[model samples]
Target chain A: MDLATSGGEPERFGPTIGTLGEDALVSGVIDRYPSAPWLTVGPGDDAAVLDLTGSLAGPLIACTDTIVEGQDFLRHWSTARDIGIKVAAQNFADVAAMGGRPHTLLVSLTTPADVPAGWANSLADGLAAECSRAGAVVAGGDVSSGAEIAVTGTALGTLAVPRAVLRSGARPGDLIAVTPGSGRSAAGWALLRAGLRDVEDPVLAALVREHRAPVPPYPAGVEAALAGASAMIDTSDGLVRDALRVARASGAVLDLDPDALRPSADLLRAASVLGSAAGSEPEPDPRDWVLTGGEDHALLACFPPSAVVPAAFGVIGRVRSGEPGVWLGGRPFTGEGGWRHWS
Target chain B: MDLATSGGEPERFGPTIGTLGEDALVSGVIDRYPSAPWLTVGPGDDAAVLDLTGSLAGPLIACTDTIVEGQDFLRHWSTARDIGIKVAAQNFADVAAMGGRPHTLLVSLTTPADVPAGWANSLADGLAAECSRAGAVVAGGDVSSGAEIAVTGTALGTLAVPRAVLRSGARPGDLIAVTPGSGRSAAGWALLRAGLRDVEDPVLAALVREHRAPVPPYPAGVEAALAGASAMIDTSDGLVRDALRVARASGAVLDLDPDALRPSADLLRAASVLGSAAGSEPEPDPRDWVLTGGEDHALLACFPPSAVVPAAFGVIGRVRSGEPGVWLGGRPFTGEGGWRHWS
Candidate 1:
């Protein structure tokens, strides 16, 4: 929730957005993203111009995601900077899931008129930082007034390989793999929701931060694609639910190993701190977080039996011919809790 | 505000979005934009795949616009179908303003959980209809839960010529031209605001419809570019305000001719009907709507002295070497009303 660390020194609270007006606020936000060469024409024009001539091959991959105020994050729990970082990470992760590298982002931000101008600037800073980390630029965006804050990001990416890795391409007998760690975000969310935010354990605090701003492994996706990934997707809706998406799409059941779903030492330590903070209740199962915690933005991929899974990705399961669903330890696991916007 | 007439017969009211869940709602919206050959990997994938190889010539033009509930449109004033049409037209107009041919749109929609599922389907129908008219496709979209309806549309367009027509390209000697009609939308908005929806005159009702759904001249943009337009912009933020943007960007004064500013007979007739419906209050000035009304999405361009203006566009003004601002009848005109989201 600390926004000041991510960008320049936070300004003393300035004018309300209403006083500054849309044009001035827009100019301030646009100033945050400095001119880049790939952005042939930046924010001043009706539309931003992007030069994808030598950069793209085969086809362009596009995806969009909208994070709303009460649904996605509570303002009291998250700073504008955290919102910006999470929005960029989730949208860019979709491009990565498609075996493509994100090159441009178009952001549509809606906020109440009473929001401070400084908050908008800090949000832009966070977006710029994340886009910079992903090797992409903020091409253009639209800002409008609404009752609560909502950020909708559309990301465009280009594939280095000829074909994109799709969720429906996983064949039977393929190895299912995922980015090194998962479930930290869900554990963090549990801690925060349980009013353990001020817990003395640094590990627990780190987990909370992870929930606020996910760090998706951007490069590993391209490596997996190059390694002949049969199918891929971002773990935005938890490991099991997203895996079910691939299972249904590919008509293959994914059987995940129970041992593989056990929480890592760091996660277990964080869970213990949260457990102790809650007094008499039994310690929450870290395995549940690992299996069903969403918003990690971790890349989950499947590779053919003959293909070498990327070093950064840990093999967690295998695809097999069966009724289309996800299984754990040879049994159908249906403890449902993944991020669903409507429900 | 009637949504039923724009597309196929409206389906009976369905279950609320909360009962259907995110995936089902997404599937319903996706079904509206059927599979197209150019969409290599469509709605079900992590990202939509667009084959832009043979379709694009130069750089791609991208623009995003978000229309919120109260700020952009009121549900009682505009139906779901009208919201969809307005979103598409406003976004596509940005591409046209850049002298590019819009090819694809990615929509991000957020609505309350209790919204009827039928409303979403109708909204998608309106989006599809407009995109079809503009020679574009609805490649993909994201739907989420929020307190109010907000549609964020990102449009991608391809330039036929090597360079895009920027607002800064106009010279002092250029002629300012606009698409055949202007201020109809504003006049329509006035009529609606004054409770003249049930007016006896059909022309007045049509104006109300125009306020709900604007039909921007899409093809004229490319024609203007091909005919060597110096600069171009869509009149989304009123003629005077948008013209001031061009004037500031191009560093030239745009001087309007008073005769050209007169409202067409069609607009005047509608205004008179609305005035009569209001009972004894002074009639709103049609000229004021022509100058300050926004959301028309009409293309406004500047052409060089020798360049022939497109037949669809009417000459309205001339660019001159002076201060960076808009002028009406050889004098700086500054009347306050224009769309400002934050205000």
Candidate 2:
């Protein structure tokens, strides 16, 4: 239904959650989820059942992420569907980062009573759609009324490889590489913060959409692991900050190349638009977004020099023996980096 | 470490979440979680790994439940520890309702930045305590800043029996029974609402404690399933409303015996306190509380006439093949029953 753009639909303003009641509202959303072979029992029961009767090769991977209104996103900038998509993407990306295949998710939402039932339904639809895209299914969830809106998802995955990837596996002399996308979500956030919306330029509009909802490189994670990547993490908190995490965990120094980390052309153009909004000032450096912006959920991994780096990955740095830290162009780069909650 | 009564502890007023930062706050809580053999990977990684290496039993059971600050509880009434215990108990009860043994859980908490860090630590401790009680472990979770406090838990359980006892399996000749607890939580809520706190009466004070955190009979679920229960559900929404659900799902009529459904002595005493608070009403019928009170999380199951009901269960009703509804005292019982969200 393209709920992100269907702001003018009449039914979008239908009965409120209070008027519709919890059961009917839950039933409407649960019906939208497509059934899967692995789901032995669906949402109507006390608990959803997953058919894990056969012996598993490896361990089961699980991760959870949450998004709250006015904290992670602004209500006017991100629609209900955008919120749903972004929350699902972040959690699934975590499983993917572990060299696992996501199979199921349980999402819960707490909203105010005045919220329209259709908005909640759209959120579920968006969540379900993304699950299907990732070859996973929505197994079950809970809904309740609260003072503010908050959505959480716990994603479960099965490891395809015998051993799951760990961030502490990066060793000295390993090469650091990242999947194609990075910094677009940060650029989108900049545009939104600058009071720019409904931008006419396709590049600018796309950036705005990315800010609202990001498409993480889900498949690249498994591909990297198959290709023998040493350590892995999803770039939820910019390249430098997240890379610093791997470096600290592995007790090695990560030396990043400046030329290889240049901002994308779209980000450069976005900086231009944001710069003009403030009169008589030079363009804000797009490199900040490239090096420090987060939420792209790109797979940042360390690979052995002897292993075949996946085709989708771009080699951007190398691991060296030293005190654990991150360096740019052979020097320590001290710039404000990525998002942190309650900091 | 009894957080509910340890309000005067100096550490309880320690640094706020904003000052502590997300990583430190998360680490403090994660450190409290005891590791287990089944947990292949713990909380520090991008995802947790559960060692489901060999599986020959039934499917995996999953369920999620959420509790909000103002909707389900008030901050003044429920301490952070009480809130944590209640939330964990509710999710585990759902798993138990499916006749599964809970093994792991992922809890997510969203709260304002100004909250005391100790409050969050206490919450995690409480959750871990309850998980231990249920023979489970806290595998992973997420923490974020938000406008208000909301906690959600996704519990994972493994079935012990070959088949799950569903709510739709009741036959015409089945006997209805419930575990040895009900109406305590509702009675507790009434005491709290009447501005009664720290009562001299030990019995009344216990009811207040129950409202804050009611314990569910976790073992009885598996006991019912093992004893060949035909239909089962947790009484999260009063006895009659939940029994009605079982009846509607099984396409049968549930005839409840009111004589057997009498309120416990604690409830009768609580009603006397509430009736006195009104100053006029003659001890408002404790029978209403027995029939309509909710949140005790007692397991209600239908058994065959010959099935040896578990020793812990009290027989309260029978099933008959007629219109799908609930009857009491040989007539159609039509009194208002149970709790419903956003009604």
Candidate 3:
């Protein structure tokens, strides 16, 4: 767990920071990423190309996101490698949310003079590994200098079939289903922010790992699509918040049964550790954490009442005609809280 | 040309910078950069899709580039808006270099807090306008807060035919021809540093504009592809510098005819400007500037001598089977300087 080398001093890699030159980092990253059949031409070429042999009229869904040091991530808590994986993971989740498969990714990075060389190299490695996990490639990217470290990733995806299952497709009489519950990452964040270590709880450690490197329900999203889900979205910003995005975009009122989430609720020990860290601030309800905390990257979808809901996911709500809002127990879900960048 | 109103103070704008939120900037940018026809479902959907009706084996070429303050750009000469244009423009050039039709772009940005609210909006304005110029659309992007300004743009292009022209495609029999010389941006960089304000000097002004936003020869690349160009590349890091890339990749040497550069050699004002900048730095040959000073964005290609060099361009060099290098007038081009990101 200790990166501190055996040397008396911190192990000094090449150029002390983003200094060995950006192209070095780029070439190094590409060297680790490698190329495959889908990649007609790889790095060193003018552009990275993927041979689209299977689908021509395939829907190309693109999504992008950035990770900024001190904002999107903390250098002390998450390594640059973790940041890169999260950036790709979160964006690819957007593609998965829409029932699409990630095909390629383009990343651009800006770093300061004080950042670690390992940061850039490991970050790219993370991206390459995650891209392969999502059945895609880290196609091409650029690197430049800045006052702080920032990693930006853009994902290109393809919906092999024609149907998109957009956010605007949810309708009344559709069963509000979700692939998994939430609040693990939020609890993990709470523990991390509180400086608590050696929690000794496996599930809590797993939850913390999820927060650091989220394993998105990639195939399960397509599973939901194939199972005839009408509309789908990933709970990136928590159940209630992301659910609202679908409701607003789909123009349908969503109603959820709070008691229905008993099984999916996150009850790990990290929750207690995080709950105590609220510091006598009259902590918010843990259910609200499940309802609104994001970054877990679970999928939420709407299907007909008789549709087959998978074993991993469950039904906790329904789509209805009313004001474009989410309701709990037929009443308004009063709390409004979710993740925001640079907060 | 004046953005200010009649009053001494700058005119106020609606939704004063304070009123617009982060989401507003995102929504504003998306609203301005409307989807292109190829984009099936653009931004706002879970993802953006490009409806690819082209052949199945079509190649998807993607590239990402980042621009950072004090590194890739200087705000003293360019605004955040101009930087946005530059960021988008530079990435588009990569697609052009691939001989692919630029179709869509994804942008990711991080900025400082002291920046004006309208800073990002104006940047978005420039991005939208520039994307239009490139026949592309801003599909999606992300934003976060940071200590300095940084913009990352990812471009996606599709080749008309299934194959892609690679830097590794040249042979000894190919005739070396350049559509035009590049170095205009290098010249402009020198002029801007010297504080040259002569807007009427069309060449100088064009040089400055080209430096700030080098127009990638998008169509000419396609033309070269169709014209049976043996190998091609965009003169980004200077002519000789990039030519060496082709030389190294294609396993062939390049030889340039000094007299073939009549178009740029005849530059009455460019010569004058270069003469002044040399100033006891050793009056280096103009060929060094034309061959090694970069940022011109000119198209360079190799073809058979019998192949017609279009009127827009002329024969500037020839291919040979010597050491992997470039030659000017039968002698190896000795210019070694090329722009490097973070030495």
Candidate 4:
């Protein structure tokens, strides 16, 4: 399917995702993905430029994220479409984490030849689908034959006006707010790990989708930065862990309100069956899961109490200048809420 | 240790790699590999831009390549550093293939955390080292933990006063000139596969290095475009196979002069020593290795007879408006030196 003229007279193969050339693949995907005005050059150029939307007027905030099969994602649970969106979402999430809106993207893939044509084109489809979903364009990419499937993307974003709400911006009086309930990924993982057969819960299913692809609340990122968010972080690592990065960088004390965070304790609903089977409620603490679950990708921002917090943002705690670290009560949140690269 | 400020850190691990968060990593790499004056917002932004050298600006060329474990390389034979340099080289070579000078690069790595600190940093060092060698900078990258190590890079390039010499531009009557020989990678693979240890020949060692980390002639790419070359290609595949790409794209007949390519036959000296022991000068032809051996990454171009061909570009044949395919000795060259992912 050559968007430019049907890829040299399309010879069957049921609407070929694209002709078998790297350039053709790029053209196919780029045709599907919308072009953003900030892109000075799109897919054909060596590189692309996104007008600087840095917190400061001139500097642009940039980030890249590469997803590898069997490493960042598993083939069994996610579709090629999921990966396409996930790759874009993850990278753009980084730009958002820095308080910038993602503008342009460059993608590249390495795969074995035996791999079906659609698998790659579908990845392109996923990339285009997600880029369109988020208002960005696919700029350029490379294609090569390799062992396993690997996808890498570089993202460029503009800060419209540079006032980056960095991790270091949190202050003593800042009120810590989480945009949504967490532990969805952790709860989802429990369902997956238990190999729950005959599962029927809708929320459990939603949690599973969240684990496979963490659709970041991007508007919230932009809103948080614009609304005087002192510091912000994406809940990539466990909430406490990712939050601690902001806390550590900000040199502020983070105090959680367990009472206010009760909604985040929905882990047991999904894990209830497993907990019941274990005959001990699995000691499921939705708080623990919310604090510990990695990949929730929710936006956590610190703001002054007077700041107009959005209705969507769930107020979790307050900040005070003190020793760096995160707390559940007086003690630090421990274990799974933090990332362990190896150990 | 930073090249700018090497030894001021606290704990001594391997190198200060994987030490920074994504933002700091770019800042750190850019801290070392600073951009030129034309660079507007080098590493901190979403994307980078360089001033075009002249009004006769060559079109921007882009390409991507990904390398993965158990597929592209044997970790035992090559270090992470070797892989890093090679990956950058492979992608940058494509820009060179387009008859453009590589200008900037973006890298993405999916690394397993357990992979030692030394290994990861060495990869960064190798990237910095090789990009310097190519006069390019590592602009930005993405990092994620994966099951297998995968690195993908997008290389951006500048076209000087001359227009780009594309593979599709080949016309009938253009003389075919290959910069160098092939079969080096085939030879290198044989050596590594057979566990023949290291051959004493410096050229053979270089051949192994070529297979491991190829340095494409960047100048030659620029030269071909400037020299009025009708079409150009990089010899990632063997000579005959890439010539066909030019053939198919330009819809012109690519004819090779076997006698003109005699200089390339010198590559068989070492192969003959091993081949004789295996009985009788290898298979159909030992020259086939040099003629068809892919991965030598030599540049090949078809220049107009009146076109000023450089001494560096070895003239092997000419192009004719005949059958849309490559020829040797006035007959169809059946050798498939082209790379196939599965063989």
True contacts kept of each: 0.92, 0.91, 0.83, 0.30
Residue pairs with backbone atoms closer than 3 Å in model 1 (clashes): none
TM for every model, in the order presented, reads: 0.96, 0.95, 0.90, 0.78
Tens digit of per-residue lDDT, candidate 2, span B139-201: 999998988889999999888677888889989989999996688888888788777765678
Q: Could you report the DockQ of all the candidates, in the order they appear? A: 0.85, 0.80, 0.63, 0.23
Best by TM-score, which number? 1
lDDT of 3: 0.73
- Here the TM-score of candidate 4's chain B is 0.84
lDDT of each: 0.86, 0.85, 0.73, 0.67
Return the interface RMSD of the candidates, in order shown, one decimal each: 1.0, 1.2, 2.0, 5.6
lDDT of 4 by residue, B261-342 (tens): 6534435665655665553444234566667777777888888889999777988888888879988878888866656444
Comparison by lDDT, 1 against 4, better one: 1
Residue B244 C-alpha lDDT in model 1: 90
Classified by CAPRI criteria, candidate 1 counts as high
lDDT of 3 by residue, B1-343 (tens): 1342111212223453334556666676677676666777777766777776644226778888888888777756665566777877777777877777877888877776556666676777778878888887888777777777788888888785547778878899788877664667776676666666344577677777667767777777777777777788878778887888899889988888878754364344655665665442433355556767776768788876667765546678789998898888889877678777655
* Candidate 1 segments exceeding 4 Å error: A1-12, A198-200, A278-282, B1-12, B198-200, B278-281
Candidate 3, superposed: residue stretches over 4 Å from native: A4-12, A15-19, A55-57, A197-199, A262-268, A275-285, B1-19, B54-57, B79-81, B261-288
